[model samples]
Target: MSKTFLKKRYGLLVLALTASGVALATVSQPDLPVAAAYKTERVVQELPMPKLTINANASSYWRDEEVRTGDTLALVLQRLGVSATSIQNFTKSSPIDLKTLELRAGQIVSARVDSVGDVTDIQFFRDDDNGERNLAAIERINGKWQLNTSNIDMETMPSLRSVVITSSSSGALSRAGVPVEIRTSLKEMFSEKFNLDELVEGDSVSLLYESLYFRGQEVATGDVLAAEVRTQGKTYRAYYFEHGDTGGNYYDENGNSLTRGFDGQPIENFKRISSPYGIRRHPVLGSIRMHTGIDYAAPIGTHILAPSDGVVTFSGWKGGYGNTVMLTHDNGVETLYGHMHAYVRGVNVGTRVKAGDVIGLVGSTGRSTGPHLHYEVRINGQHVNPATVALPTPKLSAADLAALKKYQQKTDETMAAVRGLPVMVAQRD
Candidate 1:
């Protein structure tokens, strides 16, 4: 054995070990993006099953059922699992008659069913033709129960409008593309104050009324918001306002209060009365009676206008006065007109009459000996001379003055903007 042979064997073993280590390192390195693209799919292990439990006692017992139109009470009872005897007893004891059970659509029925499939309680809720709901309840007690019924008032805000359509202005309004509904709404709104029948062909109307809308749909019109009327050469303005806690009357921009507290008087622009106001021999009565109101002899059928806006407290036949109309204005003022050919249609009790409205034609109706209108004015239920009664101007408070100034400025600006424009030529239809 020699030293040279031992060294050569040891060197060969070390080189072999080094070569094997390099080959192992190359195999252990991660693959590049391109090489990983073709890699084989790996199998995933299944997860363990989860435990779950549902308590039946905590579940809901009530069931909901939709009611269809033409469903009968017998059918409803059968659907609710109500026994025939129970239905008969319910029909007998029910406050609502059984024959009235013509079920409507979109109704809801709530029923409580026991474990044995017996109906414990049944509630029937259905909508009527007017879209009102009729609710009924039946409770099971010892295999027999009584029926209870009640009417539920649904809070609904319906839009309403009143329109006034006359051969005169209504036709023009219609031609202007104003809707018929609006016309009708306006008429209703001012029906109490103005009479559409009295409107002449050339007359014009200014409407102030409220329109109601429900969910964006126009439903109806409320009271008159405000209004103006121009017939012949006379103009009348009416305003709507609410009284405050201090019991003061409300007035509009034109300084006219909402009420005049009188009935029928010549509201048209008239000169001084021909006859004076005071107790004198009644020209028609032929007896010395107190002349309560001054006589203003205008043309025949010259619209007997309202001195102030108010309600028609009395309108109808008065024994000697012929066809008469009376209006109770705000603040304890009342006016009366007697001896008329005919009254404006729908000018009855509770009608809101406005200033300068033609209530009736001038023909002696009751005790009048001539075609002249016998007019009267009363204050606090006592007859007063209409000619000499000093009328008060509507006053403005500090806050109201400020508001008025602002409103006036805006109105002036609007008028200025339209000053140079062509006047809107309203064509009479």
Candidate 2:
């Protein structure tokens, strides 16, 4: 802490450099003594060493509580062992606006209270949309409460997972020690082509992803860099590559977009494909009949979105179809949606809608047995199979394709290292 202490730390360095036959002509050290002038002395009296004082209650600490649904400030503070008086004092003296302090579910708040029912320290780490953490600390400084806000550094780490599926994709990933967010990202990445609900045993998948962490704890997942899946003797691979400065998108081995220009499914979250679009026995009529549309079972009020850009052709009730809505798209493509609890406001006949726009809610409005969505895709005037319909995929340019190939090769090397897969060895005689 003092000039003398700093000089003592660097004394050895200066002596070593000087003794190596290197003349230290520019070095200035007026206070340093020469070896001939140095002398040892015997102490006539010894000075008593000062005793060290330690706080007995310093180990008593704070607790953290995640803000949950229906949790108020007082409730969260009480859960963290902060007394009522402490909460009152914290609320009154804190500089942060109470209205701006909107406690969201999953946000963490930490607090420590003293023996006399007073708040000694409190901290809350709030993360924003831009992946930045705003740390707010309330502590007793100089015998008074002080509120301070600072920024903490964030880090991202890459992870890899390889799993052999014995049952479902989610189950296999869980057993492979994959993070929840990574599993969700992988599922969403291949939602258009892969039917996660229809996975069979013996299927396998490998994934590489990035996780955003703060203070050594993972808070969010960035993107799935590369993923490969094998099912039924067929392999499907998707690699995330950015084209120019636009943004990154998933592509297959042939440098084609993983998803079609438009999504195929009408409902994002469906309980199951209650019935596929084909000839099947009617559940209610007890007779083999032509099933014109696919049935997606969902809750009573789940959102139903437009598969692609189109104009609403019909938005009212149809016989046996319940509250049905039909949209006319380009290239003689038309889509029909039925069994809606209610149509989204402003969605009506002749109203133009974009792809992925919410059109209605899932319901059993007309002649139906339960809550579900009856989706039908028609080309020209004839009904077509929505599940097997061939959709259009975008292709990458020549330059972009070359870049992607290089990136893919590097990613493959990283994946092999992460999984510790065996490499081929060369032997010479």
Candidate whose lDDT is highest: 2
Candidate 2, residues 190-286, lDDT tens digits: the string is 7677775577877777777764444444444445778887777887888877533223567888887775545545786644777664333334533
lDDT by residue (tens digit), candidate 1, 35-71: 4546678999999999878543333256554455677
Candidate 2: pairs in clash:
none
Q: Residue 335 of candidate 1: its Cα lDDT?
A: 76
Off by over 4 Å in 2: 1-148, 164-168, 171-181, 197-202, 262-394, 418-429
In lDDT terms, how accurate is model 1? 0.51
Task: List clash counts for every candidate, in order.
Answer: 41, 0
Best by TM-score: 2
Q: Which stretches of candidate 1 lie over 4 Å from their true place?
A: 1-274, 281-288, 390-429
Model 2 CA lDDT for position 398 = 95
Model 2 — which ten-residue stretch has the worst lDDT?
A: 420-429
